[model samples]
Target: MFKILIIEDDLKMREIILENIHRWGFDGLYVKDFNQVFNEFINYEPHLILLDINLPSYDGFYWCGKIREVSKVPIIFISSRNSNMDIVMAINMGGDDFVQKPFSLEVLMAKINALLRRTYDYMSTEANVIEHRNLILNLKDSTVSYNDKKVELTKNEFKILYVLMKDKGSIISRDSIMRSLWEDENFVDDNTLTVNINRLRKKLEDLDIENYIQTKKGQGYIII
Candidate 1:
């Protein structure tokens, strides 16, 4: 089943959209914190997104730009304002389609299914390979390894390690890690990050890497 993400601010609208998603036997996630939309997006890993224009803290345009930086997921604009400027901006901002307010739910789902089929049905796959230090990240399967031994991790652990390894020698704050894993089933908190990191450290120790991850008090973490 295709997973859909709703990035609307209106609680009622989000609720109705989610209902349609369930009716179609698909997984759907609603964004609760506008400030951390990207984190939620990655964790949910939706096939497509329904993004509204006006939002708290920042507009949908800002968030759309951020998502584009990391993913090529399909986006549809659901806005009340049908101004020419709005439609132009939505298309220019990477939206696959725009649905004016008061749109029929049936039409919305049709657009969604059509987009998903077009994007994923015959799309080429990209490998997810990342390397740093003695660690190699296998993007294809979300696996990590040092030398010839593989490191098995929970989903959160893999994400934490991936982010850290991607920026090796740079300090990554707890807040940053939280953002990367926030879309996970269990909302990631600061303490949860610490626990996951420690677990990863223990696993690494078995492979002869002692204290590989450096901790900076009141700042962040780094793998030196």
Candidate 2:
């Protein structure tokens, strides 16, 4: 099933949209951390995003630009403001489409389905790769390549790199990585994550990529 992320702040609207999304046979994800919108997007890896222009911390445009920097995930701007400039700005900010607020569920679903069809149908088989600064991580082969040099990654290393690159501009905590590695962080070894990270870094260094991953000193790691 395709995952659809709802970044709407209005509680009632979010719930309604989520309910309809599930009813339409799509996996729906809602954000719990408003400040970590990109992190949630990376973790969920949604096929499409439904973003609201008016948000609590940062507006949808800012988050849209952040997501565009990492992935080409489809984004639809949903907002009450429907001026010509708002619509234009949404499209210019890498949004695929715009849906005005107080919209009918049927209309929204139609737009989403059409967008998804157009997006996935024309995509190539190799399009599953996630890229960051010329470093390509192939989702199909589980390999990372940079400048004609490639390295294979362990399952844990791939997961760590995927999460880090997904939230490139933000710090991802060790606790979060632990939770991603295991269902419960408490069961994970304290040094296991550190060891995996070091191995991943070494592999990258082999490709002449140095300090790509930055340590935030007690915070966690970030790709910058």
Summarize candidate 1's per-residue lDDT along 28-116 as a digit string, tens digits: 99999998899999899998999999999999988888899889999999999899999999889888999999899867876776687
Q: 108, model 1: CA deviation in Å?
A: 0.5
lDDT of 2 at 89: 92
TM-score between model 2 and native: 0.55
- lDDT, residue 81, candidate 2: 93
Candidate with top lDDT is: 2
Taken over the whole model, the C-alpha lDDT of each candidate is 0.82, 0.87
Candidate 1 lDDT: 0.82
Model 1: worst 10 consecutive residues (lDDT sum): 121-130
Whole-model alpha-carbon lDDT for candidate 2: 0.87
TM-score of each: 0.55, 0.55
- Regions of model 1 farther than 4 Å from truth: 122-224
